[model samples]
Target: MTWGDGDGFVTCELGHKHWGRYGAAGLLPYHDGYVLLQHRAKVTIGGGTWGAFGGARRRGEDPVAAALRETAEESTLDASEVTLRGLMHEDHGGWSYDTVIATAPALLEVRPASWESKGAAWVPVDEVAEHNLFEPFAKAWPRLRQALRRPVLVVDGANVMGSRADGWWRDRAGASARLRDQLGAVDRYTGIAPFDVAIPEKVLVVEGKARNIGPGDTDVRVVSAEADGDDKIVETAASIVAEGPDVLCLVVTADRELRRRCVAVGAEVTGPRWLLNQIAPKAVDTPG
Candidate 1:
C-alpha cells in the first residue's frame, strides 16, 4: 500500500515456531565501541537475558522505522537520537523477524519504560560475552562484530564516469561495463585495505545504464535500480546507520546536494576518486 500501511504477516512451517504473527525490529545501540543491551523481565520468554532493544514491528513500518520505534517504547531513550547500522539478520521460518541494528553517539541512560524489559544499560565492548545473551544474538554476534566495522560505499557511477574523460555518453554501455569489470577485478585482487579499524560492510550503488552492471562475484554488495542512485544510496546509508551502531557509511560522489543530505544523517562522504584509486593498479615490472 503506502508507507506505514499494515502489510500482512508471513509464516513458515519450520520447527519451534517462535516470534511469529508479528514482524520485529531491534536497536543495537552503541557509543564509542560499546553497545546498549536490555535484560528481559523474568516472566518473559528468553527473559532475564541480555539482548538488544527490539520488539514486533508495527503494520506499515519498515524494519528500521519499527526498530527505532520499538527502542523508544521499550526504553526511555528517544528514537531520533540513534543511528542505524543495517540489517544484521532476517530470522525466518516458523517465526520471522528482522534484526535492525543501530548505534548511538553516547551511552544513553536506559531503563525499562514498558513491560518488555526489566533493565537496560550499556555493555562494554569486551564484556558482551560475560552476560547471559539471547541465543540468536549470540550466534550472530561474531558476524555482527565484523559487519559493524565495515563501511558502506555509495558510488555515483555517472559522476565517476564523467570524471574519467572517456566520453561515456557516446558509449554508455561500454563505459559501464568497463567500470563494473574494473570494480569486480578490484574486489578479486585487492587485499583487504587497511581501515583505521575493520569495516564490516561495503556497498556500491549504480543507476541509469550503469545499473545493469552487477557486482558479479565480488564481496561487495551492489544495488542497481532505475531510481535515482543518489537517493537510493542515501536511504541505504541512513538505514544502516539506524540499525547497526558500529557501522559507518561513506557516500562517494561530487553531487553537493547528495553529499549534504548524507552528512545530515550522520553519514560520511568521499569523492569519486576514492573508488577510482582503489581500482588503479601500481606500476608493474617490464623485465626482459
Candidate 2:
C-alpha cells in the first residue's frame, strides 16, 4: 500500500484514535430510495462491515474533494456523475470527519476497484439498518437518513427585484437577468437558516416584462411566467415538492400572500433579503 502524509493513526483531543492526521471524509451517493455502500475487506479497519466508500484525506485537501477522491479510488463510480447535495460534519475535538452527501441521476453500476473493499452494493434505505454496519456509520445513519434530501432554492424574481432599490423599475428583464447571473456566481452561502449548508438547486421565476429574459450562463433554472408571477411560483413549488419526499423546497419571497400560498404546498418560506445577502458583497438593510 502507498502511504500518504495523512495515512496514520493519531489520538485526538477526545482521546480516541483516528486514521487520518489531517481529517477524513466519506461519500454517500443516494438515488431512487437507495444508497451505495462498500463492504470492507477483512484486512481493513471495520473489516467485513458495510460503510461509505472513503479513506483518510490528503493534506490540505477540501473535505468534498477528499470524499470524491477516496470514493473513486475504492469503486468504479466517478465523481463527475453525481450532484453534490450538502455536507454533514462530525467533530472529534482535534480530528473531524465530513460526510459528503450527493445524488445520482440513476443507480449507476459500481464495483470494488481496490483491495480495501470486499464488495460494493446499492442498498435500499429501509434495509440499511439490517446490515452489519461499521460502528461510527451505524450511529450516524439515522441523522444522515433524515438529511438525504437536497435543498432547492426557488427565487421569486419580480418580488426580489422590487425589494432592491437599485433602479430595477426601468427594465424588469435586465434586473431578472442580473439576479440570475449573481445566483450563479455564489460558491457558498451564509445565513441559510433552514440547512447547514447551501449548495442548492436554484430556480428563478420571472414574469411579465421579465419573462423574456434569456437563461443566463449559469446553473440556475429560469422559469418564465405567462401571467401572474405569484401563481407560477406556487405552481413551481408544488411541482418540485411532488417530485419526491426527499426534496426540501425553500421559496425566497417577501410577499405575505405568496408565502402563505407556498407554505400550503409544503415549502418553507424565507425572505428575498437572505437571497440578496448571499449573492452580493454588500449587505441588504431593507426588510424582506
Candidate 3:
C-alpha cells in the first residue's frame, strides 16, 4: 500500500534471514563479454564481497523497477543507457530474489555512487567465477551467465490471436487489444532456443482492423503493422538480429511461411503454446 514500506528483514521458508519484506531484486548489467559487479562495503552485509547492485523491493513495485531503482541508487550508470533483456528468479518458497539482466554495450562508464558499495568494475563473463563473490550470487552465476544476451520476442499477433477459438472472428480489434493487455503482465517462461529462461522485449505486430491498437507504456509494445502481421513480425525479428550475432531474436507464431522467414534471418521460432502457457491465466475468455 505504501511506497518502500518493504524495508527491514524477514525469514524465508528455509529459515534463512534476508532483507526486503516484499523480496529483493538486483540488476546484472552485461556488455560485450563483461558483466558489471558491485563490491560491498566493509560495513554492509557480507561486507568486502562482490555482487550485483540491488536491494529490497517497495510495497507496490515490480521486480524490474525495483532492480533498476536499486542499481541507480548504488551506481552512476544511467538507467536509460541499459536495455533490459529478461529476469532470472530464485524462489525460496514465499520470498524470492529476481535478478534483472540488461545490456549497455561495451565500454559504457559505470561508477560506485553509494557508500554501500566500496567499488565497482566490469568483470569478464568467463572470469566472474575467479573473483570472490557474494554467496547467493555465486550460486546463481552459472545459470545467469548463459542468459547474458538479451532477446527480442517479435509476435505474430493475428496468427497468435487466431490460435485461440474464443470468438475473435467477431471483433478482431477488440480481441487483439485483449491479447495485448494480457501479454503485458506475462513473466517467467523460457523465451526460445539457447535461453533456458527469459522474458524478452515483447513486440506485438498487429495489422488490418487491429492496427489501431497502437503504442503505450505497457509491458508489451503494440506495433500496428502497415501491411501483413506476419511480414512485420518477421521484419522485427530480422532487425533485432541485425543488432549483433549475440542478440537473440525469437518469433512466436505457428505460421509455416513466417516461421521459415524468421529462421532464414538467423532467428528462432516457437509456437503460440510457448506464450499461451505463461499468459493464459491473464487472457480472459471472449464473452458469449
Candidate 4:
C-alpha cells in the first residue's frame, strides 16, 4: 500500500506484539553539533522524556511528509528548513510506525506549543544521555549519535536522468556529463545545501557514457566502472558499512531494484525529487 493508504499497520514479532499503530517522523535539529529535543509533557504518553519532535502520520500522507508536517505544527519550525537524512527505524507489530530522521540547519529555539509536548530545547550530543528519554528513543540514541556524525548522499545518475524532463534522452551522454558537472559544482558550494554539520562525503555513481568521471577536489567523489553504476553504488555502500557503525549513507535512485540492494546493506534510499528539490541554482551555471 502507499504511505498513507489503508489503516497502515505492520506486525513486529519482537515480543508482546506491542501496538504503536502510527507512523512518525522525527526532526534531529542540529547546529554546531547540538541537537534539538523535546521533553514530553506530564500529560502525554511517554511524557517527561526526551525525544525528537514527531507524531502520528495523517491518512494519505507519507511518513516523512507527516513527520515534517507534525514538527512544524508542534514547534513552528518550517518544514523547508529541514533536510531529510534517512529512516532510523521501523517498529511494526500488530501496529506499525516508521521513524523518519531528518536534519535541521540550526539548533532552533523550539517551544512546546502543542498539547503533545511539555517542553523543548537544544541538547548536545554528548549530553543526550543525561535526559530522561522514551524507551525506544533511548534505545536508538546510540545509533543516532553515530549517524549524526556522518551524513552521505548517493546519486544514481542514470535513474535520475530518466526522472528529469529536461530532454535528456535526446542526448544521454551530454545530459549525464552536465549532471556530473552540476553535482561537482554543488559539492563545492559549501553554503548552498546548508547543513547543521559539515558533510563528510558525497558519492556519485555513473554508468555507460558517464563512466569516466573522476573525483574532484570538492566533497564529492565520482566512481565510474564497467559494472552497472547501481552495482558500484552497492559495493561502495558495503565498503562504507565495513568501516563500522558511525557512518550514515543514503542512496539516491528511482530504481526499485537498486533501492532493494542498497537497503540490504543498510543504506538509506530516496527518490530523485528529494535531490532535485534541494538543488541550488547557484551551484551550477547553465545556458539560459
Candidate 5:
C-alpha cells in the first residue's frame, strides 16, 4: 500500500530465497546481436554476478513498469530508449520473476548509475555464458536466448473484417477500428502459439474505406496502405524480417496470394480465424 511495499525477501515453494514480496522483474534490452547485462554489487544477492537490470517492484507496480523503472534506476538508460516486445515469466510455485524483453531501436551507451550495479555492458549473445552470471539467469539464459527475436503480427484489416458477418461493409472504418481495439487483448491470450512468447508486435494494414482508420493509442498500429493492403502487409513483413535480427513476422490473412508472398520473404501466414477465435470472449465490437 506504500512505496516499495513489495520489497523484502520470501522463500519460494522450492525453499529458495528470492527478493521482492511481490514477484520481481528484469529488463532485457536487446539490439542487433547484443543484450545489456548488469554486474551486481558484491553485497547483493548473487553478488558480483551479471544479470539483467532489475530489482524489487514497488507496491501496485506492474511487472513491465517495474522492470523499466528498475532499469532506469540501475543504469543510464531511460524507458524511451527501448520498445517493449513482450513479457516472459519464470514461475516458482506462487512466486515468479518476469523478464521484460524489449527491442532497442539502436544500441545506446550504457553505464552503471547505481550502487546496486557494479558495471554494465552489452554482451554478444554468444558471449553471455562466458561472463560470471547470476545462477538463476545462467539457468534461464539458454531457453531465453532461443527467443531473443521479436515477433510481429501484421493483420489484414480488410481480410479479418470481411470474415465476420457483422454489418462491417457498411462501415469499414468503424469495423477496422473495432478490430484494432480487439487486438489489444491478444497479449493476454495464450495457447494458440506453439511456444511461449512475449507479446508480439501488432500492425494492422487497412485499405479502401477502412484506410481512414488513422493511428491512435490502441494496441493495434494502423498502417493506411497507399495502394493495395496485401502489398503493404507483405512489404511491412519483409522489411521487419530483413532487419536480420532474430524476428518472426506473421501476416494475418487468409488470402493465398498474400500468404505466399509473406512466406516467400521469411514471414509466416496465419488465417484471421486464430486471432478472432482467441479474442472471441472480448467480442470484436467491444473495446479491448
Candidate 6:
C-alpha cells in the first residue's frame, strides 16, 4: 500500500494503534429513516463489516472537510448533495475519530467508488444493529441515533437588535439587513443542548419597519411579522416543533413572555445574548 500523508499509524494514550497520524473522520449520511453504510473489502482491517466512509485527516484539514473528502473518495455521493447537520467526536486519549452527521434531501443512488469498499447500501435505522458493524462505529451508533434530529435556530430580530446599543433604533430596516447578512457568514453554530454540534436551519423574524427586509445571501429565512413580533416568534417556534418531535427548535429572545410561550410548545429558549455572542463576539455592552 502506498503511504501518503496521514497514512501511517500512531499509538494513542490508550495504547491502541490507529490509522492516521493526526486523526480520522467519517461521514454518516441519513435520510428518511435510512443511513448510508460502507461494506469493507476483505483486504481491509474490518473486512466484510459495515461502517461509515472515512479515513485519516490530512494536514491542517478540518474534521468535517476530511469526512466529506473521504466519503466522496469512497462513495458515489458528492458533498454538495448532503447538508451538514451536526458532529460527534470520540477521543481515544490523544487520538480521535470525528463523525460528521449529515442529511440527504433524498436517497440518491450510491455505491462503492473505491477498492477499499466491497459495496454500499442504504440500511434502515432500526436494522443497523443487526449487521456486523465496525467496532468503533457500533459503539458510537447509540448516541448518534439519538442525535439524528435536525436543529432550527429561530432569531428574534427585534429583541436581538434592541439588546444591542449599536444605533439599531435609528434605522431598524438597515439593522435587520445587517443582521441578516451577518448570519449568512456564520458557517456553524455550537449546539445549545441536546445537540453536540449544530448546523441549524436559521429563521429570522422581523416586524415594524424591518418587515421590508427579505432573504439574505445565507440560508437564513426572513419572516416578516404581520402583527406583533413576539406573537410571530412564538408561532414560528410552534410551527417548527409541529414538524416532528425530532426537530429541535431554539428561539433566541430576552422577552420572558415570549420565552414562556415558546417553551410551552416544546421549543428551547435562549436569551438574545447567546446569539450576540455568536454573530458579534467583539461587540460589547450586549444586554440580555
Better of 3 and 5 by TM-score: 5
On the 0 to 100 scale, the lDDT of residue 174 in model 5 is: 92
Model 1 spans with C-alpha error above 4 angstroms:
1-12, 150-159, 163-288
Residue 247 of model 4, lDDT score: 60
Error of 5 at 16 (Å): 1.8
- After superposing candidate 4, which stretches have Cα over 4 Å from the reference? 1-12, 15-20, 153-172, 175-288
Candidate 6 lDDT over residue span 1-288, tens digit each:
224488778999989888888899999998979999999998887899999999989877899989988888888887899988888888998689988889898888898988889998999999999999998899999988887778889999999888889889889999999888887778577745655677888999999999989996677899999998998999999999999866889999999989999999999988887787777887748532
RMSD vs true structure, all candidates: 13.4, 2.5, 4.1, 11.6, 3.3, 2.2
Q: Using Cα atoms with residue i matched to residue i, what is each candidate's TM-score against the true structure?
A: 0.54, 0.91, 0.77, 0.54, 0.86, 0.93
Once superposed on the true structure, which residue ranges of model 5 sit more than 4 Å away at CA? 1-3, 184-197, 216-221, 224-228, 277-280, 284-288
* Candidate 2 stretches greater than 4 Å from native: 187-195, 281-283, 286-288
lDDT (Cα, tens digit) per residue for candidate 2, span 189-236:
544533356578899999999887767688889999998989999999
Report the Cα lDDT for residue 110, model 6: 91
Stretches of candidate 6 exceeding 4 Å from the true structure: 1-4, 286-288
- Pairs that collide in candidate 3 are none
Residue 160 in candidate 1 has what lDDT?
69
- Model 1 per-residue lDDT tens digits across residues 146-234: 54444566566677666665567887767766666666564321222223122234566777767776766665677775777777878
lDDT for each candidate structure: 0.66, 0.87, 0.83, 0.66, 0.82, 0.87
lDDT of 3 at 243: 88
lDDT of 4 by residue, 154-202 (tens): 7888887777777777887777766766665643112212222233357
Q: What is the alpha-carbon RMSD of candidate 2 to the true structure?
A: 2.5
